[model samples]
Target: MNSMPYIDQKGRVYKYGEFFPPELSPFAYNETIAQEYFPLTKEQAQEQGYSWKDPEPRNYEIQIKNNQIPDHIKDVGD
Candidate 1:
């Protein structure tokens, strides 16, 4: 049996319709709801019907970590 294409919160398509990781499934649905509402707060997000936990904080950390210079760059203490 083939899996359905998973639509992500950002409306991104993944896998055989399944998200890259199942863990992200909730975000996909939540994202869709957020977009439909156009502007939503943490409380509004829930009211609007998003199910996944807030991703902003986690995403921020990821962005910061990704943009940080590698240890090698700082190790030199230039």
Candidate 2:
């Protein structure tokens, strides 16, 4: 696992084992990028009008199979 801090294009910082996959483009893996773009917290991301998707639990599969969509996506049309 990489121990360096990385920032995504949208300025979200993935510290150490934050588990961000590549191919997201412009993946910043150093302090320089963080200083230049200013990594954002989840709340800050929202305040800046960027959409952030939080991960669901592994049980989400069971919930969906039971026709129980999570509240966050409850209103999403099928």
Candidate 3:
């Protein structure tokens, strides 16, 4: 980590800029920016051995749900 070449999948991600592959990210693949651009279903993400999380529907009167929003801005309405 210091000056030595890190062996793949050997170092702990203790700091920012240190990262694992998309499949290894602690956050669900569906929750990552990759999902925002290259969308994938729960099945698709899991089939690739990537993490997937089914978020619990919140109980707020009104919530800004970033998850499961429309891919196209045109589809969004007030």
What C-alpha lDDT values do all the predictions have? Answer: 0.53, 0.53, 0.70
On lDDT, the leading prediction is 3
Single out the weakest 10-residue window by summed lDDT for candidate 3: 5-14
Ranking by TM-score: 3, 2, 1
Candidate 3: C-alpha lDDT: 0.70
User: Candidate 3: which pairs clash?
Assistant: none
RMSD of each: 11.8, 15.6, 11.7
The candidate maximizing TM-score is 3
TM agreement with the true structure for every prediction: 0.25, 0.26, 0.46
Encode model 1's per-residue lDDT on 11-73: one tens digit a residue: 655656332543434464446654566755666555534554556654433534554656675
What lDDT tens digits, residue by residue, belong to model 3 across residues 1-78?
555533434343334356545555678887779999989888887766678888899887756667868999998898
lDDT of 1: 0.53
- TM-score of model 3 (CA atoms): 0.46
* Model 2 C-alpha lDDT per residue in residues 1-78, reported as the tens digit of each score: 355677666566777655554324343223234425777766765565444555556753343554565567767777
Name the regions of candidate 1 deviating beyond 4 angstroms: 1-25, 28-37, 56-78
